[model samples]
Target chain A: MSTKDMSERPTTVLQSLNAAMHRLMAGDSRVVVLGEDILDPYGGAFKVTRGLSTQFPDRVLTTPISEGAIVGLANGLALRGMRPIAEIMFGDFVTLAADQLINHAAKFRWMYNEQVRVPLVVRTPMGGRRGYGPTHSQSLEKHILGVPGLWVAAPHALGDPGSLLEQSVALEDPVVFVESKVCYGRFLTRPAELRAEEIRTARSPFPTLHLTHRGGSPDGVIFCYGGMAPVALEAVERLRDVDGIRVDLVVVAQLSPTPTDHLEALLQRGISEVIAYAEEASSSAGWGAELVATIEEIRASIAPRRSIRHLRIGGAHTPIASSKEMELHDLPSAELVAERLLECF
Target chain B: MKTGERIPLCNRDSSPNELYGLMFGIRTFEQSLLDLFQRGVLAGTTHTCLGQEATAVGVFSALNLELDCAFSNHRGHGHFLAYCGEAELLYLEVMGKPGGVCGGRGGSQHLQHRNLYSNGIQGGIVPVATGIALAEKLKGSGAVSVVFLGDGTLGEGAVYESFNIAALWQLPTLFVIENNGFAQSTPCALEVAGSIRARPEAFGIPTTEIRTTNVETIRNETSRCVDAMRDGAGPRALVLHNYRLGPHSKGDDNRDPAEIRAAWDQEPLKVLRERLDTTEVQLMEAAQTERIGRARERALAAPRYEY
Candidate 1:
């Protein structure tokens, strides 16, 4: 019984989130939805929460335009034996709730010596595409990576966001669920003519879809997630078609408490060079930097015999400008990934 | 008390004697901490609710202990002790012992026990209390949530946001602003604009002002407001106009000595003592002092929490 023959249809990222909320609330009465403008008729800013408040009138709460209060409110609800899904509207606004999210929610369990479990999911759209300027258009999940005791889940383009979101809600710890703004309307992709088993395996929870070219060991491996997955795939195709560089791809679904073991296993599969890319604003402590550190640690400890070279592709350190040119300059494109892949090889 | 009737200054269920006991316990505990800090026994300094005992004690007296939750600010020792009545845990937590409520991870400013929570940040718990009330409302538990904030917290934007949402949703929440006349060194008059009630009242929430340190009056007003909330009357604000007789924190007494001394006359202990017989006052004071002394010894002797 090959998994490829399962006949599962593709779904948009928005549909995945909506379906996840419906299923979560339907199955568990404890799950609640709260955010600004999330009530029916208004939905949310990106309409990800459309029809949710209407379906679950009493459970879904429409909060005021207060990110700090909204997050703190969710923390309170979670502490009081309720599973709360709080939406921050935009990822950039998470800065406003940093104190509650980082100091209170993240440390509550540890500080309280496990007297409480903060089972809350904060869903917000991250990454740039709508020219939302510096504040609105940001992959702010990078800032949340270093926070202790907080889990971060970012569903990739090929992965099932609904399944991941459900997992996040059921988790016993606080989670920051990041949905890519650009990926919301895009359809999940599968290589044409692939077996149903291959597609099913690729969509499995935390599965690393390694797409190799030339039917053998790839020249390099690229790691990415969310909106960057599609761009990375396009880069893979271009590298193989034009530059004759056969590269492999390892798209991650969970970023924080990163799937380091899976990444180490992928690296151990004999690709001598790897490239870690992120759409977040570049810094010394960016996600790409963490990935590089993990790669180096894994290489040093586990696979020292076959030392691999690593290159990181992250956003520009400067704030994203509203203009198209500067926006383009700020974020990494598939062409840039392709060029970087070729140069690294 | 009838549905629309106001709670009298002293009622059968108000338990003025027990409330007085709790107030005395809070004061004794705080005074012991001050002594401990001076002797270098307690590591970090604490913000004592010296002059604000009646505000916390009165409000806590009105709460349904089985259902209600409270969120307190930096001056939370009084609230935590008044609500939970666990003087030993508070002392142990301050001493960073394993037997403490939070296992010594959360010191004075971050004490949490059962339904009571407190943090050092101003206005941070306002929304958290609203959320707890919202949860209770959804669960059909008829429970009310209370938050104790200072006049200093009025400057935070989250406080107003919490009021707006709590009022809009009709959450069973009560916001008690301990207008201690000063936000640290800055006087409330200089920091706050207009009135403390104006902000919550703007959101259509009912407001009550209690200008005295009379625990009986505070208990009556809070009981009325809490009852209204239990009857689905949304959020209410109580401005307990009191003064901070002590400095904000240890060794930070920036307030005028004359003003501090003047505010001492309004101490709740003094007010309660005046109403009681001389023998009754002496008995209550002696009992509370012995209770705190024993709690301090136990807390000090408690084994340290190994991290």
Candidate 2:
């Protein structure tokens, strides 16, 4: 197939992640995959790790239901010169592995004084569209964003998650690769009416994907990431078509390190009047709060005199209910995003 | 010894003098650390392997240091010294000097030198070592991963999880439990329940229990277990029923003075010193004392870790 045909072909986010694993395992002997039920036939809970065990049976380890040990074991493999991608069955279980990730994997290289490098990636699905209830569905990446040596990357459906997964595996530091569960079955194609450009920076390997209307500059900008991209895009379209309000959307792939340089550069490029930080997690102390803090810091230097209107949008503080209606009501939606963006204006 | 030099395996044919020298060196190094702490020359806590020297010296001496990986806990001075014999570098590391093994960043509890690693947390290294063994198994390297845990760490749920995975995967791992009768100040009676051997045995891992301070016996048994692991016999556990001669860290002894005094009779140094000649033992002691003194001087003279 030609490059254009391949790019235009409809691929699900799940397929992209699976292909990323296959490519990584095929190209590098050091790369290994380990998780519960990640073997052939089962392919994990979301099927993102499908066919990996059949392809690389020896390297693809189907571990017991031990979240802490799974991550801890991956840290050991990474320390001993192997590129290991460990899967926590769900993003919520990542709390069980927090000690291994935060204390051991993240602190190993620096604490060991550069005596070792942990090229480890921990992949997990995070989001609440299905009725998986309180424990299984949570956007807990915020808990680990403040870690000194760890990297956090969340790939959206519109971007190439496969390449982002590969990039995360290639990094010298340990990374928490958060995949949105809601985006698994979605097609990995950008909308035709929107123009997308990947903004690259030296600070992070993953690029920030900027999406805007085809012909005109947007009156406001909405910064979202991972699964929130689709919701934000829907909101953007509704704002433009129904209310005649044009708003651009920025989808961030790398959540940690705050992507300050990219956000600063975008704001400096005159895309700053009305902004909204939308996220799938809770609003208090969530990724949106961090981004708002970062934007506030950026605005101090870039536009000290001008008052930039901004709003933070996220899920409610209560535990996500199992009912689909309540779940949708709790989480950020297209209508909510539009209403919040109007508030920003 | 130079960095990355192949460490000689301690076996039956190895000299008693050499083995004694290793155990004695560890004892001396830890004693010097205690002295340094008392003089306010060292910051942070130090877990001395004063009475448990035989386990470290014996277990590390048996493993092929070039390929095998060893994971240790907070009381890891003896293990580090036994694995690499880098007393001077360890001294520098404990003193927070730039010339230390991990550039003075790891301080006393955390250390990494080639295949040997250590951390301060209890029971966390179990899964880490199991994972290393899994890596070695995957690479077909025929190397066994060994982890040292105290009696106190048996209560951690992660240890059991690691035991289950190590047995389920048949990874080449050896879990060495140094049951020094106490976890910090809590006795094993208060912390551990049932038989410790039955724990790993429940996971289908064959275990051997040794209740001696004899370095030779411990070394011989560890070698046997390591050999079984190399031959793909799966994970094994070695329970060393030893005692802690010194306080847990610094001046934190809660045990009876009589118990501590009685345990000194079975200390590795005194036990091994009985086998050697009086003149030879005296000469070895003096040499180790002077060598350790010089290491401390050099470590003190070295500049502090900048960052």
Candidate 3:
């Protein structure tokens, strides 16, 4: 809303995130980065933590390959007056630290009569691109968002990186930072002239703006976030070819408390059917459940012209395997994403 | 029941063995509970840490209160007392009263404090302590975590898992195995198959098996190993081979007194008493009077926990 000072605009999510992370590190001494191979020995498996160790050697620590240990240690550090930014090698490995993350970090303050505080951030990659299926590819943010004491920050665009990320790190509670593996290498436009769209090989998860159809208005809306945003955009493109229907994209940057205000206002503008979050993992507790819950609360207030649908694709209540074939079998592709988007009609 | 003979830690001190004095701390602590139980004052059943105090006190005494965090077992009053002393919140818990720790929702087994934490599950505190130590090591806090488990817990793989992780991370943790020889009447020989201290040593951890009953000797060994760990040397274990002074819990009311008398024959506390021939007569009387007074005060205060 305050774009009067938009002297330089970002065109990619990772670029915006990079600028935001750089700003945060320079601003706070309590903020630090950690995880396996996050240091110069190897600038992290995804480069999300690249160069942080060199810039803040005392703060950026490279831990052993133990997701549970990473989360547990972060919980401890957070309680001990440090805002630790921990990383799991992959989203799949986060299951290993469920005991600490779900049970301790999430419940510490509430369990201890509000005596403990877990001011920490977890940065990990989910979703597949390079054939790292079930085991390596998962957008399991829902698994953690349900836990208490944690606020989920999943920016879908490069814009507002400073506001979204800096506020997340500065919030008094724990924050979950989810990065999609499929989007890590992507680039973006910072300014029309001074854009630095570098090939992101390091393990750094940056931010970029997603201008699917710059400055376009639509009669209908689709609310979504995380790795599925791009897929949803592709599906929207395909859907437009068939009916030329005006489709609005509401790319959410946060997931914990659904943004009902934005969606409601869009729906009020005569949108017939609005599709919400969907992905692999399980239709039970993830976005599917959240969609139904949010819609149920506001359905009575919506006009007769508005409707909501879930573009879900999930599996049984077990961890997905890392096989490419199985992963593809698990998550619905861009074609299916298009099909589901049309189903709202 | 003190015969009033005190032995000094040194030849020149001319006082009671400081080690036995600390055991008396736990012994007196338990005796107070027993008296309260008989007087129908302390409510609910308790798993006394009578015979196991030396191991806990020895190690806990070496801990730096400001930096160290401890995970306690179901039987952890000594731990609570050693760390923060007279945890009134815990008393509220046992009394099944509103003001108790856990708001009385968790009785004796669920004792927990931030500086000192615990859970009701057996060998449960092992992993919890491992996690705490992992936190300390990760934060570079120079703080150490210690968990005291019975030999019975050796059979639980959770302890082994915790040991593997603690040792793997070189976490500053002290694993104290109070081998009082039994797990609720099931002897350790009947349960644990391999060596106990070997569990840590196999992981290249520096373990000390000080099979001593003397509180002072236990303290010396615990302090040495805890010192090494606190200095970030790595996780260490101490196997205090001693005798269980009382039945497992008040539920063991049917326990044969003969069984206790039989175990008392090799009593580590008794062994300690015999080593104090040079104890001064005045200090001996004073130690006895102190023990009795402490026990009486606890008994008269009425069990802070009321059913």
Candidate 4:
């Protein structure tokens, strides 16, 4: 491995998203942005859309507090040959626009027999760490995970947000591009081999990254993305240093259309146990449940008859509390992740 | 379907026979669906536009079919037929045949044929239509987008939000409110508070109200309004005051039968039939029934979806 460039740090997720929007708007005249409180100065609640209105005043629209209308408007724009990226201020507010997204935007292409292409991108921030309470701090992407024809792309801590978003904007299908609230300011670091060149050139519907522990054969693997990406890495390092156990980390950039190829390939590496971590609540049927089912189905066809143990670590199944302690208790911390891995082993 | 200039109903190529033929097609098709439901042929219930044919035919007749688009509400059979005019396709869709518009996935409420889209959700299509208009304005296509909204949809906040944006952006959108007396089982008087036209008017959109069920007059006004929109007049609204001649759904008839009978007198078909020859109308009705019978046969013969 090459020496780390400590002086040179990677761009943050928010910066990457901002840069991606700017690039997309600059490249295509049909690219338009709409969101509540997305005007200049305020930019947005999270400021991911900062400087966009200033650069593209005619294209950037400041919408009212109508999530349903905002998404539907984007769909109309897409149908009219314009690519629109709608920003739902918070992930939880996506429930208001569920009717449009689930029914109209997702089903427009197939429902119309592929005569129309709805290239609408719905960008929203998910996950909570700053004690934003129950409404604001939720990983609600799982609720929409199973929606057919909808692509959900979540950026890891070190994932290329600009490239993922650029690909999302160019997609013919509707995409639910999720940005982690906690990971917006977090710096992205990757192995020396996984450079920016390869990240920008990724064209798959689902892009995955594999980081091994010091080039050693992995004892296990942890599958995660977005806010949990950093936590999984931390857990990996703790296991290697404290317990002398080496594990691999897999970051899945795409959450929907289920990334079956990349996942099956990972399982084909013949790992004995796989651990999945998510920021979503521990619902009965979530991304983890789907992932486990897919892994089990693929595992049945393996020649060696490998008995791969699948474990999951997710957020507590309760409303996020306001207090710092309760907030920490609600989210799956790195300590808890490492402890869970150790217990499973 | 021709663009550029507005065409008046008198100068248009459509004769009364064709117009009545279209109306008769929708009425008979919906009647057949009701009969099918009663005879245990159909599985689910459907909302029918039995009495609101003129509103769909009139407004749709004014649109440039090749350029302008439309979004309809639950009672959208008339709207879909008015735009596409394919009775066989509508039958296949309603009968869950693979030859349906949405390949049998979407039934009566969820109809999509070319530029036409309809869903069962109230007020959901408003924002989508506004966006379509926004796209039209941005492309400088001079094409307008029309949303067929029910009085019940007015209760939804998203509808007003779409109105505000459509007016604010000067989008060429037309909000056609089919203000049939009752929203499902609830009466408009009990559900809606103020005047229907006043709602869009507050958003600075030009509002038009048609009290009579005259198809020619409705088409004339719609053409004039559509021409104004094409001339960059921004968003406008029209409230077609009408009544439901049948129950809300197959097994939900909370409305008084006497009120329905009274409404049947003012129904668009009856109102428009008064202007046409009685003998010709009877022959047109017979032809419409035969056409619907052929369509039903084709739909039934078409491959049904297994899943």
Candidate 5:
């Protein structure tokens, strides 16, 4: 009933995701799996899609290296009353399919006056660790935020993933569901239900949407999302131990639609200037641009006196370095966050 | 009559003439669009489906109202109207006004409206439509996706990529190349190196080549493709030999209109009209014309698509 009890049993993030996919496959015939190296033998590059091919060999489709084809195929399938889940081997590899996403699926609904329902999910492994540098380490959230027809998802917890994943499939729109390579091992947390209900509702979280721990304090707030959320949380620990200044954490599991309501409230509660944005993407786009733009808009609308500051530490220009230590230097890590926090202090 | 055992595209008895009437409807639909273009109401350039109307109207006829999906190119109003009931929004789209399907942002090239979607980029909609076909196949709903591309699109690597997947998986898709003889003034002869059928057949798909001018031929061949896909036959390719009445767009008129003019001399539309009994075919065709005439009057009467 309680999250404490749930984590007592050991399980990998892949197991939880596999269970969700299994349950989803049972729930609807429209559900299909697609990706490279996803078959009876290898499962997938990281074993995430392992065993899927065996159970639902018919539904699990193995595709070629063409990113455009994979993405376009998913879009077409979704339009034909089927729920398709497409996987790009690497998050960086999806750039090759930009034509289908940025052009077709994303704009279809708006351009066509809601005549087409792009009910498909694109799931990929993103973020850096183990030296996957520039190309591999990129967080493409900003690039997609501007697209009108898509629903963006970045599930940071195991239990929450169930509801999020279910909702993503049911949504009558295209979705980009991302999983961080680094945060996968951590135990997932969800709410406790009573002795009766199956907890059938997929929209709301267990009880409250917020989770409180030593991870909560409000000297300042760090609003980060995707792979960078955990880093921001760790940066809080670094700030308190080193600078003796406490900070609060607000991680956005969803990037698009920008969570305007939650963000507006956090800033209103007497937090200092906001941090512009982070992660390994270009400066002109992504959270950095919208993060600061939101701050500026709220400042003008709510408080004229307050001003938010920015310190950006993102992916380097070169290809994602394969060497582990060099990879650490390539992405903005805890140290970079500590530096930014101290400068603010 | 024989292009070597392969059925000649101009086989009159092989196609469905009634379907030609519908393509005629789609043809005038394109003409209406062109008229709007000439009036400066519709913005951007378009690839009109004038001579290729049979392909759109005929193939679209094979679909179950909401079951089948279509992907179109820059030249796309005919395909857009093939699915009934949203013709007004299309008018709004080309007009580039607020009421447009994409709220005017997509304009002509990015035309879409739910299940019926299309893009202007060459070979852009091909792979995407093939994906839709794959989804239909996976869902087991017997749904199919049809992509209408120009012969010019053969140059894109993405099209070839989708072609491989569709044929390999036997996804329920049909790729219709409106071989309008020219890809923007460059004849297909100048652009393509080999025959169209051999290209797709090399990928393990069954290919059908038809002369779209003969509506009956278009209807029969495409109907077989759709039925075969729905029955789990995988994918099929349709290569249409059609010609444009004018230049690629409104500006270029370089063609020696002689062949087209001679073809028009046969008066296909007039002949179809004659074949119809005075009551059934004549009434329907005339009524169709009358309805469109009134539509034109109403369209011009309405507040123009202009700001």
Candidate 6:
């Protein structure tokens, strides 16, 4: 099948990811899956690795509860010419493997003077909504975003997450694939009237998904990604319906290396007058901050005289509460996002 | 005599002259590094395997370089020398010159040559080595992966995690613990509790404990272990009890002078010298000195690694 048809085929975030792994393992013997309880009868905590072990029992490794070892082992495997995808059951547990990821896997390529490539991927379920409490629910991709030689990718439901994951696994450097926990069951569909364009950068292989209205010019632009992409899209629709405000929503898949060139080009084209950066993670020193900084720098360089109103929409600066009401309060809601986007106007 | 009491004479594939030459080469190369550091010719720090040359030489002698791979730790000059005998490249690397093993990016701690890899972080390479073993096993490549660590690394949680996975998965891995009786001057008594062998043994990996600086003994035992691993005996652990003759890095030694002197009596070179022909040892010494001197001159003449 052609790449276009395969991507056009309908798939949920979970199904897309599972099918990608299945396709990768079937086509390439070098690709292997390693994680805790990722085998048959238990397809991992999120079922993203379902049927992998059964189909390729020898290649699929159901590891012990050791996140650090899992990533470290993946690094070794990648070093030895095997493409390994290590799954951290919960994104919060990624902290356990931070040393290996940050120090070893990330630095191997450069530290070894490009003699070796660590084609390893660490995929995990992140974000808060299911009331799994403080530990299980977190958008912690921000912590690993700026690490040199490590690629951080968080594909949204609207884009081809499976293709992004495949691209990530095929890269020579190590990548952290951040899968939003709440978005697993979400279908990868977009409004018929909305137009989607992918913007690629020289530094990164993952493309940024640019979503806009079919004909009407947007009053403002909102940048969001991962689980927050759906929320941002909802906010855009609500703004148009209630306040007659048109907003363009950009779903970024690659979070690291900042995609400065593509973002600079977007700003230069003047996509919208009022711009807002939104994310499910906390606003402090996060994706929102980095994007805002990039936008500000670009705006300052190109159009210093013109004024562009900007605002950052993000989760509350506190631990995500377990209660449904409190969790809703802490997280960014469509109404809250729309209300905040109004401030930019 | 105790395991580490004296160097043992054994009939092995490598002659005594070859073993002594390798050990002497490592010792001189390390001493040159110290000399270069004192003269400000070398920058940054280096962890030399001054007192632990026997383990590197012994374990590497048994390894099939074509099939087996090794992961080394911070103190890895000995292992690097024993595995490939690339003194010129190592010199270029330590000197931060071009054409080094890792293009001078890894410096002294991080090095890669063929199937041998070294890292500065303690206990981090254990899992990496285990992973390599897993890859070899999956590939059906009758190979064994070996990782060298200090007693200090036992404190790291990752080492035990690697042990658990290696044992659980039945990977053909050899975990060699070079217990030099100190964790950068803290001593093993203050850091390690219970027995080191019991740590891996608890994970169902059969453990072998050796307390000697004898390269022949280490080579023979490691050959047995590697042979078994290649034959699918699963993961094995070897606890080699030796002593550190030099400072952990540069002039950081805080141990008593008397104790250092005591360890010198059992140093691998001194012990092995007694078992070899005096004339041959002298010739090997002259040859190593000239070889290393030329490597140093060539490395010094090489250009610095450009960005």
Which structure among the candidates has the greatest TM-score? 2
**Which candidate would rank higher by lDDT, 5 or 6?**
6
Write down the TM-score of every candidate: 0.93, 0.96, 0.74, 0.92, 0.84, 0.96
Per-residue lDDT of B229-286 in model 1, one digit per residue for the tens? 9899899999889888777888797777888888888788788877777877678678
lDDT of 4 by residue, A267-341 (tens): 666555646554456645777778888878888877456676777788888888878898888789888878878
The candidate maximizing DockQ is 2
Error of 2 at B147 (Å): 0.6
Candidate 2 stretches with Cα past 4 Å from truth are: A1-6, A214-217, B1-12
Give the Å shift of residue A313 in candidate 4. Answer: 1.8
Task: Name the lDDT value of residue B215 in candidate 3.
Answer: 63
Q: Candidate 4 at residue B96, lDDT?
A: 76
- For each candidate in the order shown, give its overall lDDT on alpha carbons: 0.80, 0.88, 0.63, 0.82, 0.69, 0.88
Taking the tens digit of each residue's C-alpha lDDT, what string does model 3 give over A1-345?
111224355345555665666677778877767678888757788766666777778777676665666666676567666677788889878777676666666666664545567787777777765577557766677777666566676754323444566766776677777777777644431222212121111121222222333344453445556676666656556666666655655556666645455445444544335554546456776766776666655664765444555455554465565666765666766677666656666
Q: Which should have the higher TM-score, number 5 or number 6?
A: 6
Tens digits of per-residue lDDT for model 3, B1-307: 1111121122112133555555555566566667667878667788887777666666666677667887777778767655654434544556565555555555676655657766555654576577667667766788888888888878765576667767776888888888887888787788888898887788787888877766666667877887788777889988878777777876474456787788676665676677675455336547745644643443245344444
Q: Rank the candidates by TM-score, best first.
A: 2, 6, 1, 4, 5, 3
Candidate 6 residue-wise lDDT, B242-287, digit = tens: 9989999998988999999999999998999999999999998898
Give DockQ per model, in order: 0.62, 0.79, 0.18, 0.64, 0.55, 0.74
Q: What's the i-RMS for candidate 4 in angstroms?
A: 1.4
For model 1 chain A, give the 10-residue run with minimal summed lDDT: A194-203
Predictions in order: chain A TM-score: 0.91, 0.96, 0.79, 0.93, 0.85, 0.95
Give the lDDT of residue A26 in candidate 5. Answer: 80
